[model samples]
Target: MKIQIEKEKLQAAYKNACGCVKDAFEKLFGEDVLETAKPTLDDYKTIKSYEDACDVLGLSPILSENRNKALCAQFPDHYDFRQNMPKHIIALMKLEIISRALWGKSFEPEPDAEGNKIYWYPWFALYTKDEVDRMSDEERKSLCGALFGGAGHGAYAGFGYLTADGRSSDSGADIGIRLCQETEEKAAYFGRQFIELWAEYLAYGFKVTEHLK
Candidate 1:
């Protein structure tokens, strides 16, 4: 004779299963942490393998043998979760939040009518040189806050380059209000903000830094 499981017991088991899955993901991916690495436009393109890219960026792979084993052992019911989920989902999420917070825009992926993926373009990479020059210094500073702010800020900036043509500051003003928020407590907040904004102008292939002064 087969024994029937109680409803409460089934619910508890399901909750435990989800917790185990989440814990397994954390252990396998190491909390989805971001690291800063200064990659030139070429470096971003040269790497053909994810392992190579991870090495260049000093990022550990979210799916390794040991991490996978830990996940499988902890969450037997959902051992295939990592494989089923796209690896870039976390990176995309981080980028989405940062992009929206800084640019007031979203990074939309280009797709065909059939819903097949085509390309991903960051909002900044689409800017014209004239547009970059037209933007105020305050706006540029916010986009490039990583250059002046801490490592986390730099990581965010580096991640921005993952999208097509992300290296060009001309498309999107890097500096503005976010930089102010990032360094509000510093004594030279205003000065640093200006400095960061100026750097972005220079990076955007500008000839006259004095235009803003």
Candidate 2:
């Protein structure tokens, strides 16, 4: 459940994965939708590590907290921006939705899917249908939960809407399993592979798949 891998590999791999998703996004969605995510990929150049990612996700929690009323009395300026989620975060959100769409599962989100403060946990579990179907729910939970122990900046472990509470109304494994494989498109291969490699590494480190029932 612990890791010693260099943050550089994770940083590079995440950007590559984002790039691949962006390519798919352009093909499936439109340039307008793609605009939100474009800046995030470029952000990788300077925001190059787990700590950096945490900071980025922490952009303005107040805007989203307490039904857009967290510490609002102190900062009236954020009132406008807090009306909706930040554009870049929405872009990342769309990326995840697109991953689900590839599997014929559509998402009509309504402030669901608590944002990942750690970033990687959301995308790191990307897996082809066969690849993830091979994993049981508990296995998937452990793998995604591997990073739960990370501290600071209000970081929590596990993927899905579950992070907001003790239970997962959405299935993390369902999201993890549905990816490129469903499309049968060649472009999906590398993206899927990059995700797969990191998944295996995390699984190894966390021992999630070592003893599956």
Worst 10 residues of 2 by lDDT: 103-112
In the order shown, what is each candidate's alpha-carbon RMSD? 20.5, 17.2
Residue-pair clashes per candidate: 12, 0
Best by lDDT: 2
Summarize candidate 2's per-residue lDDT along 129-204 as a digit string, tens digits.
6766799999878755764544222333324444444466654442343222322342243234234333443344
Kindly list the per-residue Cα lDDT of model 1 for residues 1-213, writing each as its tens digit: 977766434433443455677566446434423122332223322232333344444544444223545446655554333444543443333222332232212323321334233222222233456866887899877755733465332333221223353543423223222322222232132223233333332354433344332
Best by TM-score: 2
> TM-score per candidate, in order?
0.18, 0.19
Q: Report clash pairs, candidate 2.
A: none
Error of 2 at 34 (Å): 22
- Candidate 1 at 98: error in angstroms? 16
Cα miss at 154, model 2 (Å)?
A: 13
